[model samples]
Target chain A: MIPATLNVYVGLSALLFAVGLLGVLLRRNTLVIYMCLELMLVASTLAFVAFSRFNGSMDGNVFVFFILTVAAAEVAAGLAIIVALFRKRLTVQVDQLDGLKH
Target chain B: MFPAIFTFLVLFTAVCAAGVIVCRNTVNAAMCLLLCLVGVAGLFVCLEAYLLAFLLLLVYAGAVVTLFLFIVMLIDVRGGAPRARNPLATVAGIIAAALVVGGLASFWVRGHLAAPAASATPALGASLKAYAYPLFTAYLLPVQVLGFLLLVAMIGVVVLSRKPDPGPKP
Candidate 1:
């Protein structure tokens, strides 16, 4: 059986992160942008797991747990903000959310 | 065999991630995100982090994606024409992402990758005992702080989503 090298996992993580970044930059809908943010979080978690596996240390896994916790909290707050914004403006488009630009 | 599986998982994840960005329908994008999360969980399992893999599948694919779908439905976003493309933002984002990937690739190719020591414990991957000791002892404070952060986030969500009281009309 061919062994999977560390570079393969790292490269995958990099690609995932780039895709997420592109989505965040290009998407106009708040919900889509939020999904992209979650994608980025997952990408980072993949990297952390890869490092932990190769280095044989549990530190990276521990950090991944903390990242998961923080990401959950962030999503809760972010979705609440999205809902509130939608309630007031009736639109989830980011460009239409420039009320604070004044 | 393992390498083949790993390669397939990586490609699956990349494709799903791209789908999340390229799909116009919000619901479809959210589903694509779910697939991407599941693919990442598979990657975790391939790395032998069983607990983390399950946690990822349960939390991200199960809970987070569901929450996204619920919000998408609640917002009632209809399928419409794609938003106007921002050429400047796309160009800038591509440049930034390329730079980041290129830098990391070069660093990896330069022989700076940390070679794993030969002392890797056999139980380090899937064993809770290996993780519990340090989590409860060395990293206890951060764990406590994490709980506190979650509590605050819960309260903030409630406060932020509350409906405004009706006032007398002029």
Candidate 2:
């Protein structure tokens, strides 16, 4: 059984990142957009782990540990903000939330 | 056998991620995210990062995706408003995404990264002790800082979600 090359892993990571970026660009729903952003983060972490694996380093793994920690916190805070915005405005749609445009 | 498994996992993850984008309902998107994360964990296992494989599953699938689902239900947003046939933003976004993907593909084809063979690489991520050593030593500072960041985030969320004071409630 041959191990997949590092390039394959990195390419998969890039593809996922691009998909996430596209979601962020095309979607107007704030929650979905945020999910896409998290997707991008996960994709980067995959690259980090893959690179670390190929290079025989522990740094990337440790970095991913930190990223996981931060992600948990970020999710909490972000959802809270989204909820608050919804409560105040009765909408989570980004286009409608543009009160500063006037 | 190994490449087959890797290819399957990659396809699973990519499809699920795209499912997140294409699914109109928020709940479905959240579920797609969960599945995508699970596939990523499978890929992590392939990379021999056993710890991160489980960590990604535990933190991301167990906690993060659940939170997303809860919020989706609480807010009760059904789906996006089917907008008019304005193709401009959609077309522009597709172009941008394609450009980014094309650039990365070209770089991958042209880039000459001298990666060491996997057999020669140390599987540091396969064990718990290897992880603990760094968390307590050279990377100790970042660990401490992340703890503080978590605390700050908790406090900020509490404040942000607090019920606004209604003046002179009867």
Candidate 3:
């Protein structure tokens, strides 16, 4: 069984990131948008791990760890905000969240 | 065997990631996100980053996705008015995503980036000690800062989500 090359991993990461980007742009639901954001973060983390494995360095792995930590915190805070917004507005649709547009 | 497994994991991750966006139900989208995170963990294992694989499964799949599910259920958000599809935004997004992927693929094809030759040194991500040695040394400051950031996030979530004080009933 041949081992996958670095390019395969990097290309896959790029594809995943692009898919997440498209989701963020196309989705109207706030929660879906948040999930897409996490998807993008995971894509970057995959790239970091792949690079760390290929380069025989700990730096990339360490960065991935930090990214994971930050992502967890971001999700916690972001979800709380989403909940608060839902309570006040009764909807999570981005199109309906135009109170601040004034 | 390894490449085959890697290919399967990559495909699975991509499919699930797309599902997260395409699924209309927020619950289903969150579930897809969970599957995508697991697929990413599998990819980490294939890369020999066992520690990260476990961490990803534990933190992301176990904690984060569950949190999303809880909030989604708690909010009990109803399906609202269908948003009109914005053709202009769709076209722009497609163009931007295509450009980024094409640029990266071109770089890969040009042989501008290559993985370093595998060495005899211990793999950093496979073991906790190996990973911690660097984390506690060169990255100590950043680690400390991350702890502070987590604390702040905790406080912020509590403050933001608490029920407002209500006036006395008439």
Candidate 4:
């Protein structure tokens, strides 16, 4: 049996979210930024499950089902876009691909 | 046994996520993400979300990370170029991130719901029947729409990955 409280789980969620946000802000690699976005999504799911379990409802769990499905599709599409970008520009670094900065 | 496991999972997931940010090599970052997903699955199990936990492992750890690795290999972008320190952007990004962290910390300090007593909390069984009923009932339309969305995504990926025409820049 687990002896932790809800606050503990929420704190973990907050911490992960902060880390993901920091990565998105500071990291220049598009791939790393994308991975950090996924981290944020997963952290949100963890909080959802914790709330669902602690509140004794299935709503949170069901939401995670949808999130997982959507995230998979998002990853597929996003990666395809990244690959296409790489082929067109030959660089995955964000700063080097600045064609629109007039 | 479980709390100890939960603590370990939390630490493992956080460390791996941070590694993704700090690692210069794209492949190394991808590997960190894989480990992070595994740790998240463990955390899901701790929350008793048995099915979601498995799906996370199967979909995220299995498919998504594999796709990332494949892309990294194909592009052969081993390590990111060393960043030139831009003072303005660095300051702005750091300030924005700090604001977000501060907001979340404040939310935890004051706004989070008080956890009810464990014994008083109702038991939400992590069973398939409990999940399937709602997905098939209340969420049926969303499910159908998402199915359509997935098909659209598949078509889009196919279109995007095709070779561009052999013409001049328009």
Q: What does candidate 2's lDDT look like per residue over B4-96, in tens digits?
A: 888789889989999989998888998999999999999999989998999999999999999998899899574346556448887888789
Candidate 4 lDDT tens digits, B46-65: 77778888999999999999
Give the Cα error of residue B119 in candidate 1, in Å. 11
Top-scoring candidate (lDDT): 2
Question: Once superposed on the true structure, which residue ranges of model 1 sit more than 4 Å away at CA?
Answer: A1-3, B79-83, B97-123, B167-170
- Report i-RMS for every model: 2.7, 1.9, 2.2, 2.3
Model 2 accuracy (lDDT, Cα): 0.88
True contacts kept of 4: 0.62
TM-score, one value per model: 0.89, 0.93, 0.91, 0.92
Error of 4 at B96 (Å): 2.3
Sort order, lDDT high to low? 2, 3, 4, 1
- Quick one: best DockQ, which candidate? 2
Tens digit per residue, CA lDDT, model 3, A1-102: 334777777777887787788888878888889999999999999989888888878899989889999999999999999999898889988878899888
Error at B113, model 2, angstroms: 3.0
Instruction: Compute the lDDT of residue B114 as modeled in candidate 4.
Output: 79
What are the lDDT figures for the candidates, one per model? 0.84, 0.88, 0.86, 0.85
* Tens-digit per-residue lDDT, B1-170, candidate 1: 76688778878888999999999899999999999998999988888889999999888888888899999989867534456766887788778777867876785677345545323534376888877888999999999999999999999998998888688898
Q: Per DockQ, what order, best first?
A: 2, 3, 4, 1
Q: State what share of the real interface contacts each candidate retains.
A: 0.65, 0.78, 0.78, 0.62
